[model samples]
Target: MTTRNIVHLDADRVYWTTEVTYDRFPARQLWALAAPIHELVIPARLRHAAGASRPGDLQHQLVTTFQRRLGNPVLSRLPGQTLLETTGRSSGLPRQTPIGGRRVGQEFWLVSEFGERSQYVRNIQADPRVRLRLHGRWLRGVAHLLPDDDARARLKSLPRLNSTAVQAFGTDLLTIRIDLD
Candidate 1:
């Protein structure tokens, strides 16, 4: 039950080493078990505070920073992961984001955790035309924001891991339907 503290270049990357009662203990495996518990047990008051359209507080910054700096890079490289490429509203540059969604026939569907406040969602508003990467291929598509769609119900129909994340961290849920070419 000894704890070891690891400090990286940044505070966000800090890792604490801890011994668990599980057999064949490994740091990665321990983390794999602890991460979900940590997220799920977040206080309701904190979740509510962090789940605003644009939260300027520390919690929101911490979550977004870790995801952008670490999570996105890892998820984007995974096989069969869906990616959404949107045109930046002001910069007019291609902004590629790794997303979770399902492809059914000629349409792809997903929900945004941050609703219109998400960067990708805002980009889609600027220009409905977008591109999607799925099954190792890039394809053109048009994005449609479905405000009327029930986000919680939509999560039930999406991949479990992503749906769980959306439910845990999302402040405002937004549904997006992409018509593929």
Candidate 2:
């Protein structure tokens, strides 16, 4: 596959264009796998090159878009993952976000990758009351955001795969504890 950017400049206008060419099967398969990463990296790099104040913000946006649009919706339906259902702060609707946490006695603990920037975290801030789907059962709980808690150390206690992501793309990591009933 080959990509070309053609720039045609005139006195009154500038035309910027991108052109892509690929072979029948092999190149198409390669591009299909690469497109997602390319979509994320190119914009992020462009933003960074243009001296954007927060480069991490681009990554956060990309991650959240993936989670909100695709990942969460798919994962929430699966019985295997833990899902936290928070009341939407603005819409007053239920928002279920797939999460990685552990249950200990009467409590459930997890870390928010974006802290209060996360929609569900913001929802929790507005209303501490929430419902968690644990082991295919919904349990009522009161959520608490622990800003002072060591989120890095707390991640160590959570699921490894999720904790790795939280550590990697997380801008403002926050620990959350839920008192389950």
Point to the candidate with the largest lDDT.
2
Candidate 2, position 94, lDDT: 96
Clashes of each: 0, 0
TM-score of each: 0.68, 0.78
Error of 1 at 130 (Å): 0.7
- Misplaced by over 4 Å in model 2 are 6-17
- Show the lowest summed lDDT stretch of 10 residues, model 2: 46-55
For model 1, the run of ten residues with the poorest summed lDDT: 11-20
The lDDT values for all models are: 0.79, 0.87
The TM-score measured for candidate 1 stands at 0.68
> What would the TM-score be for candidate 2 when compared with the true structure?
0.78
Clashing residue pairs for model 2? none
